[model samples]
Target: MSHTFSLSRVARLVGVPRSTLQRMVKEGRLTAQNGEVEMEELLRVFPDVKWEDDGEYARVEEIKKKAFAKRIFERALPDKEVLADRLFDLTHEYATAKGLLAHYEQLFEWVMHKLDDVAEAGGAPAAQAVADCKLWLRQQLAAAPREAERARGLLAEERAMRIVSVQVKVLPSGHEFFVEGSDTILEAALRAGIPLNYGCSNGNCGECRARLVAGEVKKVHPHDYVLKEADKAQGAFLMCSYTAVSDIVIEAAVAGAQDIPHQVIATRVKAVELLDERLAALHLTTPRSQRLRFLAGQRVRLKADGVEGEYYLASCPCEDRHLELHVRRDNRPFARRVFDGLRKEDPVTVEGPEGSLVINLDSRRPVIFVAWDDGFAPIKSLVQHAMSLELAEHMHLYWVAADLGHYQDNLCRSWADALDNFTYVPLWVDGGAPEVAARILDDHPDLSHTDLYAAGPAQFLQHLRDGAMARGLSPRGWHAEVLA
Candidate 1:
């Protein structure tokens, strides 16, 4: 029997993005049956993939670590109990395969004995036929197939992946992520940039309650919220408390912009990084027990020293407990405080993550991001979010700066350098908004199959939208936010 792997698992085993596999399938370069690839087919498709050397996999992991701004311990193993359960499952599968092989061997011996009996009863012709059959069987059994070596390597690599990290597929939303190390399902989901609804991440409010649809889960944390008997029978468990022992499917709610509640978190300033004279990046750390939950490209109200202002988030939500915002050197109270005297450990309150401009998580099409001046803040967040999800086929960033002068030029360049599918083009606003829009839109003649997110002044957005629409961009493909 041939083994099969899910598309996501195959991506991991072959050290490529899932989007690459999907593209191959679409282009008819690869065959997938019901979203699974057979081992032979996978080997045939990626003949040159070196299973023993995980260089590509390591590179991807490093990119994800930097993109999400989360520290990933490469050597961290799964929880002890989960590891034991996985080993037990693997052992059971091994035993079953061994038993089947033994049964096949016995059947082969019996057939040989029956053939001998027929040869003795019949004559010289029957004996010769039996001898030929026996020789063929022995020859086949003695010979190793051409794919044997590669198959062994592939299996070994996949087995290691299974023991180290298990994939979790959330129902309804179809979001998938891998639970690595000692991370619970919720932790893994959040780390992957999937906004699953949860309050009190330590399992107190039961807001993260979900039902297991398949596979097994082990409780790694105690929860104060008690489930009713009926609910328990239906496999109800808090996502915050359980870790997956195998590839799992669970029904859970994925939060949208409207679904997330308004939160007021008292965060402490971690640093005030001045990118230039005009712009500063305020780094804040939320309380351990009260992490702020907001989608990428959202704006939040920041309050410090009895003054508050609304600014777009400059950081991805996958960065647990850490939040980043860009403040321009204006007369705004919050911006003034940020540039003048914001110090480490100073209390700053964050509230109302208020904005609808966010990443379209479901889209797998190429994405184009346009930002004007400090609008790069929210655009940066969305880009990092898309990177963490690994859903975009390609990402193009066009930064049009007037006074700020591409403040984070090195970061943008790093993204383009590290990722094959990322492109960065910085433009100067010498000829006004329309000219900048023209320069950006000139590169993308056909926006029919792309999703474009732009943040800038109202005039720039209007000019860009008109040009994008003229170039076959759909109305639904356009997402814009006006920033002064």
Candidate 2:
């Protein structure tokens, strides 16, 4: 055995509490065998301790050290429940019989052999060998029956698996969804039609970030994104890579809207209403068996006559089996067909309703909408949907077009006249001037509390976003749909 001192003795010599030495051991700053601290470890930890050469002190230290060592030896072994007391006593008796008290490894090996023999006799050699080492010791002890019972209890506990379905409550919207032990929160939410924001389904992107407002979740996979310590402290977790461990309440970054689920269906053009010389409202009728279900402000990919393009659904989803797509003449093949060649009864394949530009119908904040030209298609869908939802909040629309005629001023004026919560502002701009953006900023000087939605050309959206941020609106408070 190595020359060692009791931890209490080392602490007494070093003029510190025994708990301090224990703490160092726990922290891996120092090592201890049971309650005994090695002399070399003591010297390594504290080289500054004053040593006394007095005979009386040396005699007392030696006596205390022997007793402490004996006590540690007794306590160092595993409990009788796991390695029964009878086996411990038998080991001692065998060691005494063979005069091999110092040969602990030999005695331990013998005990293991006996356990293997008993396990083999049970006709389960393979299982016995793996679980034998500890059980063998228990079998040699007098409390073998009790120890075996305890072992069974521990084995069952370890074998038990947690596979319960957990309830996940989303904040702000109070939307509840279930996440099975196998599925992630994001996957479950998406399946449940809870529009949670997500970029990469794989954990690399941090787009699915949410706060664990209450309860626990376990990371199901490694993420390429490095989560900040501050964010972790605030209970932030990537929803794509985490599964709920218990019933949880999470505050997701995205809002939850009770909109219809998305669908892909075949439809025929009911009529082509030319609202203006440049704008064609193509009304498509879905088969009664499969009507497209979509939220307002969401776009659908329409494939017709060898051309496939995305267009926003202009009519409210309440108008089942009927779809209205506002197509403007941009000289694109799809636009040309809609304005000139496309006729009634033409077959149209509508796919999707993707995009997360829907309203936070629950938010009580005032809403501001900015749309330019044909971008008003989705904005019109949104306004009508909001009115249908009876959103009791104030709403303002700022429609910008090249001229008064292109602004769709009549439709906006009608809404303004009918809805008490709606306001309309028609802005005429040539090629999106900086003054038009400045005028919007001038109108809403403090946009801090407003939920602003902007849909236009990329440059126009960027300008409005930059101007709004500079004016006081948070980036989180700004939502955009850039028409390319």
Candidate 3:
């Protein structure tokens, strides 16, 4: 027999939010039917969710049924082997036996006192024996949280202890969190509704690296050179595996970002030019009344149906009446929206100019503009903005693109020549491979110490970040116009 089920049911079966499931659908990451999400898909995220098709609410009912079954089976068919194995792991990991022993004692107590309730005829004695062991194990388990501190001479310490809450100034996109029973800062932030920079929670991957500003913490678990002791002293540490005994403040710089004021304004696709079979230059125009004050390199999101994106603006900001974006012809079902369904004069909606790629008209800092691929958007903006401010000579530009031809038909060169003080360096990632950075460095090592600006996809921007950091560049001296 076969059955069909709704993904809504599947989402309910798991403890995750519906937004996560919806995102999966939008990204085409997880396959689902109109009213049917497969059991296999549900189990991928939660190994415990099961099916109960006896009713219309199959997955929901299934979750309750499964959890009930789990409780029942745990009591009925208690696994001494699994318990013993867990005991071994806990004993190896922690110096104290109380935690592991408490669980063991609980099981032991349940087995001896409640054996008859769980047993089937002759099984009563065996279950009772397990419970007896639990009572004996209880002797080894530590006292409760309240009592244990007294035994450790902490009761007197608590009498003198004063609790002070201080507000640490977290960055506009940074946050804080604490580790209980320990003073080690964790590798991830504790924001309620945001994704922290985390990779492996096992302390092996250093994905949640950040810097501490106030408060102190100690390491709880071992880390694999994710952060050196010296680095920690220098305000760098991992958040994933660290425990914060104190209310320490840390900053990831890009985390905890909040959405700013935004609105979708009517914009028209003004022109579309075929640079090549694989590339396109798209121009969009807003009504003269609705002037889009976007930077040359800033992008506005275009939404159709429900899909929206951070498409870079190719037109200089000086032309506030019109906007332009250059899109690579990615051969995908979604890509067809722009490459096929989209027309030169099609009505489009745009919402943004929300980024840090604009001209800092007040800053006297020299700018080193680096654009990888379609990242040329912001550099062009910076160039034009510099021209407007008559600070063009202070602006330096480097364009690194995957396809050199993409820059050919876009009329990018004419803008480059017209924009004073905007020097262009066009190099493909593969054309001059290994020495790309080296040659550029040789030509301009001043990037080693300048206000560097880079814009591109997450990976490209990350690469630039890593390279710049390796070359003794300070974070304050570096800026990025990243789109992900």
Candidate 1 lDDT over 228-272, as tens digits, reads 999999999999999999999999999889988999999999989
Candidate 1: regions farther than 4 A off: 69-75
| Candidate closer to the true structure by lDDT (higher is better), 2 or 3 | 2
Show the lowest summed lDDT stretch of 10 residues, model 3. Answer: 69-78
TM-score on alpha carbons, each prediction:
0.95, 0.47, 0.42
**Which stretches of model 2 miss by more than 4 angstroms?**
1-262, 430-432
**Which predicted model would earn the best TM-score?**
1
Q: After superposition, how far is residue 79 of candidate 2 from its true place, in Å?
A: 72
TM-score of 2: 0.47
Compose the digit string of candidate 2's lDDT tens values, residues 1-484: 4456555345445554343455567678888986567656766675544443223234333433331221111112222221333244445655785676457667877877776677667777665564756765656764656434543433232122112344677887755565643567886665444557766667887988999998777777679998999999999999988877655789985444333445678899888888888788888988854656577788989988898788998776545466788887787778877876788899989988787677765655678888888888888777765544333256899988853245357767766655445789988895455777887878898988788877788877877888999888987778889887
Better-scoring candidate (lDDT), 1 or 3: 1
Q: Which candidate leads in lDDT?
A: 1
Note the clash tally of each candidate: 0, 4, 23
